[model samples]
Target: MADFGEILESIGDFGLFQKLLLFALCFPNLILPFQLSSLVFNHADTNHHCNADWILQVGPNLTKEEQLNLTLPRLPDGSFDPCKMYVPMDWDLSAIREYGLNETTTCTDGWVHNDTIYDATIVTDFDLVCENTNIFRAAQTIFFAGVLVGAVLFGPFSESFGRKRATQIPMVLMLIFTVVTGLSPNFYVYLASQFIVGVALGGFRINSIILATEWIGVAQRSYAACLSQVLAALGQVMFLAVVYFVRDWRIDQFIMAGPLGFIVVYIWFIPESARWLLYRGKTTDAKELIQKAAAINKRTVPDSLLDKALEEKPVEKGGIKMLFASRVLRKYFLTITFAWCAVNLAYYSLSLNVGKFGLNIFLNQLIFGLSEIPVHFFCMWSLEAAGRKLSLMGALIVGGVLCLLTLAVPQSNYVAIATLATCGRFLMNGAGSICYVYFQELFPTAIRQTATGLGSTASRAASMLSPVVNMLEIYHFTIPTVVIGSLALASGIMAFLLPETRRTELPDSTEEAEGKRGPKLSNPATRDCEDIQATKL
Candidate 1:
């Protein structure tokens, strides 16, 4: 019986069909940054001060300077205290400038936001300042909480219902929730919308991989995986460009959501995974898609090929249980999950906390987005040359070390600090790209999505903790970076323990995953590693 790999070899592997497939699959990734990093724009706190109605009473007739002098208390820096104002007492409008009120209180009426920075934001609109700061973190946490839930749900969903539907359902929901978020009239509604958006995004994250990687050949799989990640960087640039002009948070949401809606129509062009169809005993369906693919790629397939490809091989029921049942599988599961958690935590730590760098945040964000582009090319070269395990470890170790070194760069030299941070961001982008391909390659096809989804759950769990870590600036400045950098370092060391999957045929069954894979195991030596360590027992 011919394996899927054999069938791919018979026809063109990197043919026109696969190239088109790669492009179609990248759209979701391009939109992902909006849901992932929109918090940067949405949660921004514009300059503000206490809004005392009595001050306005004096301000209707007085200049702005006189009203601020009478109503707001200046901090040590001579800037008005946003959270506090002079208590309204015995203020004569006739001599407002002369009237002095010493007693100060929290802003009881509301805040006067500086519209120049943002028309309105989640922070400014909802008053997430002062004692309510924790609520802001809670809101960000709730979004990742939804992603954690999705990590559990989408795995089995992709396995059972098929990858195309799995991809479509979440995409449609993402569009709907994003649109609703923009239209949200109140804070609670926005929170709910964000949670739902995250849920849908989680669904997209898992299914997009299944759709993209399942169709490509092993040799060029790294290219497909890395190129898809480049879209994530592209999405960040798009977010900046859109928000640069559309400063209103609601309008920004609207602009981002619009493309997602249009994409729903275009996704119809993307075909379901033929490999998944074969896994489910839908051989006829798989053959039909393969025929269509051959036609699209302008390749010829023998008439008997379908019959040989349909030859049955026993497939195990792979899930969370199957992963832990064997010692080898258990080790693989634990190591990858922890690696995912550490890498994601470190990656998002810098990605989310752009404000803490003490630089012009917009420029910092632009640089961070730009930094990831080179990483895609780096992954393309390194994953092929050094193979998966070596490249992955290199990225994790380097990214972690660079992030830790960021602490040594004095904050006074904002440019130096920002440069080191961008380099850290660059390395993690490579680490993360390799991890995405590694997750799919590591596990059995039967349970691959489930295991990948579970890993995603771990990563999202780490991401959920990030807001709290980022919030730790109130207690200590270095703590968040320390925690994430430590995680990256630890995970990088653990990367050595797992089996290398580069150039190895993806495991099709739990038994295959459990079986011994000495360096000489796989038949294809074209792209397999030279050293025994790449496929060591």
Candidate 2:
């Protein structure tokens, strides 16, 4: 029986066709997140705040003149005078206005505001300050909270079903909620819809990362993973374009919702992971998928090789318990969880605060997105040569240092701060992609998805707190940057403790990974001291 790696070797390595397939599948995942961000950021409530609307509630007994006197400016200078603003003392008018109210002219003399009429309407109900700070924060918190739930569920579903199926289901759900979100009649409904949208986003995000890595050869896995995120960055850039054109949040949500229809096209072209199929005891299906992949690469598959690839070895059914049962596995799990949390904390905190950095919001997002192109290439190069741990450590350290530097600068030094922050973003982005690929590589195949899902959930959980942390105003910009920097530094130190995995074959089982027996197919050379210790039990 030929080795599975050798069989893959028989096919072309990272050829044009393989790259094209990955590129097509990666494109949608990348674009979808940014489009979703539009829904998050451009809602009517969000825009009203951005536009500085100070909505105030006033009694209906107040004439239009009186209402205007209370809300609108009285001075010729067109500035509001808070001292002169007054509202009617009538409780009935206040109650009606609070529920829904309309006005009509009185026949007796001057116009009289009527409180009896009821009309349901969507109106900005908060002052500009409340809208900008509290409302926006609420939206961000809810969105990520949904993401946390979806990410937790993403792995189990993907493992139970298949990668392609798991990946597409979220897109369908995202399409449904995104369209409905735009049509939401009230703030509560809109918020609820965004939460659902976040869940769909969580599923799509995890599957996209997993599937992208699964489809490629080991030699190309690192590069493929980095490229997938590069596309994500591109999605961020594309969002700027979308936001520029469709300024309204509801319209933007609809626009984002519309492209999801294209994801249905993936059902025809995207193939399930051959590796996942092989692991799931669907060897024949795996072989068939591999053959189609070979065909796409213009290669032939031998029947003998295909049959050999189908033969099963003893493997255990993995569950969440297996992740923490062993010392080595426990260590990897903890390291991955911390690293994921740190990455997300810094990544999201930075991304969510880009508008505060003095660059135009659209241009800031564009710059941040464009910076990722080089970061992805740099990550691919570093991971392929220097290995995973070092790449991650470098990224974390660089990002942390830059984040700390932000504290020393003033708003007047906007360009300098932007440059530093942008560099930090690049490093964090690259580090995150590196971590995703590295964490998956470290786990045994049986529990890979579970571990990945757990790590993703941890990251999302940490992300849920980002908005709250970012909302802190006491220390100005220093507080958030300091917190993000400290977390990154901690993650970098923890990363150093993880084992190096460059050129090392992925472990097939926990026993093999622990070196319980002789060297396995994946690692056939002299055993290290740690391997011997792991095998001793």
The candidate maximizing TM-score is: 1
| lDDT tens digits by residue: candidate 2, 1-537 | 344555665565466556876776677756665643553345323221011112233343466454543333344786433223222233454453465323221111111212121111122322213323367577778888888888888889888898887778888788788888779876788779879888988887778777767666677778667777877787887787776765555666667766677875664467787778888888888887788778888987777878887888566784788888878888988986898898888888888877778876667778888998888888888987898889888889878999889888886888888889889888888888987888767887788888888888889988888888887755575788889999998899899878777655556688645534332333324346556878996
Please name the candidate that would achieve the greatest lDDT relative to the true structure.
Answer: 1
Record all residue pairs in model 2 with backbone atoms less than 3 Å apart, i.e. clashing.
42-249
How many pairs of residues collide in each model? Answer: 0, 1
User: Which 10-residue window of candidate 2 scores lowest in summed lDDT?
Assistant: 112-121
Clashes of 2: 1
C-alpha positional error of residue 343 in candidate 2 after TM-score superposition, expressed in Å: 1.0
- Lowest lDDT sum, 10 consecutive residues, model 1, at 515-524
Q: In model 2, where do residues sit more than 4 Å from their true spots?
A: 1-3, 43-85, 88-133, 474-477, 512-537
Residue-level lDDT for 456 in candidate 2:
87
TM per model? 0.94, 0.81
1-537 per-residue lDDT for model 1 (tens digits): 566776776566789898888888786688889877778888886687788767665557767777787788888998888889888876567665665788889988888787586777888778888767568778888998888887778878999988888888888888898989988888899989999888888887778877878888888888666887888898898898877777788888888877898889888668888888898888888989988888988887787877887878566774778888878888988987898888778877788888667787788889988889888988998887888899888888888988888889777888888888889889887888888888888888888888889899889999888888887867888888788888888899999998777676677776667654433233446545544555784
